[model samples]
Target: MISKRAQQLQPSATLKVTGRAKELKRQGKSIVSLSAGEPDFKTPQFICDAAIEAIQNGFHGYTMNTGTPELRAAIVEKLKRDNNLEFDAAQIVCSNGAKQSVGFSLLALIDKGDEVIIPAPYWVSYPEMVRLAEGESVIVRTSFENNFKLTPSQLEESITEKTKAIILCSPSNPTGSCYSKDELAALADVLRKHPNIYIISDEIYEYIVFEGDHVSILNAAPDLKDRVVLINGFSKGFAMTGWRLGYLAAHPDVVTAVSKIQSQETSAPSSISQKAAEAAYNGPLDEVLAMREEFKKRRDFMVASLNEIEGVSCFTPGGAFYVFPDISHYLGAKKPNGDTIQNSTELCLYLLDEFGLAVVPGDAFGEPDGLRMSYAAAMSDLEDAMNRFQEGLATLTVH
Candidate 1:
């Protein structure tokens, strides 16, 4: 029998929506998909060249379980240069993308029944990771009016003695909400009072900000450096999601503990991918910058266009590639066939079936009656997807 853990865990809802869209395209249907979470751009040539070179030079053999010393040093340098945060290489551990780093962190730190405080709408994998680690996922809801940002008071209210850690994501996945320095300082104040609570700050979308210098929770209060685990990677920035290279920076003891999980589970990230990641750190960052500008343009257009549709309210995000628009006006709405739109899933399916547009329902991200539309596709596709979505919403009759 499959483990109960595996049975209970929800499949990635983004991929589920994306797969259906792909199938429709394969079946010769005209589809407009905004469900993808990855860059449409190709991996930059410099990173690819390094990976090819590594493979040719016999990098197939596994090296150290944590990572090659050179790659670890490169990540340390990149973090310091890009985020203005300093950390020793001994405080870092390489893993198979940010997912593994998060998974390992939970596995290493969480004991059964311990609570992990997460702000919603979070990346889809977070709560599952906490549950898989035998920890309780204590989710704090964020509203559409604030672009889904969590207030310090809301975070404080969620805390209890059983709270072991807080999962923080900047340029957050579902809503693209980035925290300002002052905002992070507010959160830091809450953490400072709780010495035992660790902060797992996920900065995977660091380089894709639309405006303002990227702010990190760790940078807000360097005094709590030992308590903050900084998670990041080459995926969103360098268009290197396929490479699966990511790492974490924390206290030496925490890194060593995560390293043990890495050693036992993944036996370290792929050697070739690590080499490619080093190139991402050392090579030109211009490609990623240009891509960020393009995404911002698309994000602005999509947010505005979605709001033009009747019954939709969108918050223009400050970072990341997703725009989540509230569709709560359609809840309890009657369809053409008389079935009421009770929640996001039914609404999402209605759009997918009738208009051939694919969007992940917000329920998967801890918000119902909203849909996550990714601007990760080309502008042409973005324009088409919004048109179809507008038509789809027109089919519903709501109060």
Candidate 2:
């Protein structure tokens, strides 16, 4: 029998689409998957080499529940260098990935019936993580016209006595929208007034920004540092998703709480992965920069192409590798077989079934009129996918 917690949980829609695409490919279908939020780039050679060195040096044993001292020190230095935030190594806890880091932070802070403010068009995992922690998700839906960013007023209005934490993702998944320094400051100003609410700033896509600097909320509101849990990882920026390394910088007590949970659960991430992540932090940034540039180009191409589709419209996202296109124009439209498409989910299914294109519907992210397509694939694959998307949409006739 499944527990209520497990029964109430919805599977990750992005991974579901990706897995289905894989299955279709295995069955000899030509599926163009824009579903996964992973960089197509290979992990840098230097990081891989560091893992090999660690293995050869007999670093296969279990590490400290928090992390290796060397890796934690490197992470502390990284925070100081990039985010302009100061943290002792004890304030950091390395986990399996940013996903786990987020979950741990939620579990550390949330209790049953506590509310976690999540902006809509959010990453699919945020609400699920809250559910796993027995917390309620308060969804604040943002608009396409405003670039899908949550405003300071919106944040202020969403806070209630039961609000325990608010999750903020820069260069966000599902929608590649990013908050500017000024925007973050405004939100921080409102946050400063709500000292009771904790901030979980997810900066996993930090280096993937196409415009301006990646400004952390800590940079904008250093006074709130004690209450902010900064979440980051090597997955996106370093093309090390498979290595499964992420970490959080928070108050020492929060770190200890998360470390306790992790000790009972995963008990420190992979020893080899931690070594590889350390190399990523200590190595050159040239490969990361190159990957960002390529993603920028893909973002541009994908946005422009999606806009050209007859009933589709997409804004140029400021960062990350996704294009959240407004596909409401096709909702209620008729298929060639006379079936009516009632929602974005139906549209996504139609696309997958008709054109073999895999994408995540916005319903999974709390927006029902849009769809998210990751541009992290090869440019040629993107080109082919876009062509198929165009061809597929042309078959729908507005009722």
Candidate 3:
């Protein structure tokens, strides 16, 4: 028999659906995919050059288990410059990616039966990671009416002696909602009441925000800095997904516990990657600004187009590249092929097979009546996907 943990784990539905879409694309189909999560931009030339230089310089040996001192120092400096938070290199642990950084925090902090409070319509991996750590997830339902944000009262009501941590994702995935400074402070107040629970602020999309400015929870309540483990990475901000570099800025004890896990598991993030990441954090500012501005334009275009479609309503995402729209109006309707689309998943499948446009269904994000469409594709690709999607839905008979 398989281990009980293996039995309990469900596969990532988002990625699973995406793979199916990709399969169709590889089968000589002319597909427009709206299921991407990464930026359409390529990694900067300078960052790649840095990695190549590191390899030539023989920076290939195993460095510190946490990370190289040089890389950690650069990260520490970047945090100070961007977030106004200071931490020694000893407090940082560079991991393979943001997922590992998040997983490390959970592994270090969670005990069996302990609960992590996760807001719904969350990133698909959050609850599963908690379960893998043997921690229960106490799901708090955040609503579109409230812009899919968790109120302090929701967190307050959910806290208990068994609660271990609150996982916060800003400019959130799927929904692209960002919390304001005042809103983050409200959350801080709730956490202050429950000191036993730690906060893992996942800021992987920090630089991708279209809103006025990013308000890091660490910046909001500096007094609670020690209790907050700030999670960020180069993947989204630097368009470096394949680089596999991410880090956590946290209390030393937490870093040490995670480092121990890394030592036995991954040993350390790639030596070359650590060097490239250092360059990413310390290098030119203009490239980062350009990427952010482009994403903003794309977000605006995608949301506007989606909103214009009949029977579909979408909010302008504050950040990130995804538009989550309410698609209940089309459900229970009949398609041109005479098949009835009863839910979001069936609707997504209908679009994929009929119009050759791929999108992820919302059932994975805790909303079965909506669909997630990513604008991370090129502008032309996004335009095509939207048009095809609209036509696909138009073929459906009104119920």
Model 2 steric clash pairs = none
**Candidate 2 per-residue C-alpha lDDT over 303-388 given as tens digits, one digit per residue, 9 for 90 to 100:** 88998888788998988889999999999999999989999989998999789999999999999989999999999999999999
Best by lDDT: 2
| Per-prediction TM-score | 0.98, 0.99, 0.97
Better of 1 and 3 by TM-score: 1
lDDT of 1 at 14: 92
Candidate 3 C-alpha lDDT tens digits along 1-399 = 999999999888777777888898899888988887888888889999999999999999988888899999999898888878889999999999999999989999999999999997788899999999999999887877787889998989999889989999998988999999999999999898888889999999999888687889988899888889999999998999889999999998899899998899888889999999999988996887898898888888888888899999888888877888888899999977687888998888888887898888888877777788888888999889888988988898987
Show the colliding residue pairs in model 3.
Answer: none
lDDT (Cα) of model 3? 0.89
Which model, 2 or 3, shows the larger TM-score?
A: 2
Which lDDT tens digits does candidate 1 get at residues 259-325? 9888888788899999999888988888999999999899889888987888889988889899889
Model 2: per-residue Cα lDDT at residue 158: 93
RMSD of each: 1.0, 0.8, 1.3
Clashes of 3: 0
Q: Rank the candidates by lDDT, best first.
A: 2, 1, 3
Error of 1 at 1 (Å): 2.3
List residue ranges in candidate 3 displaced over 4 A. none
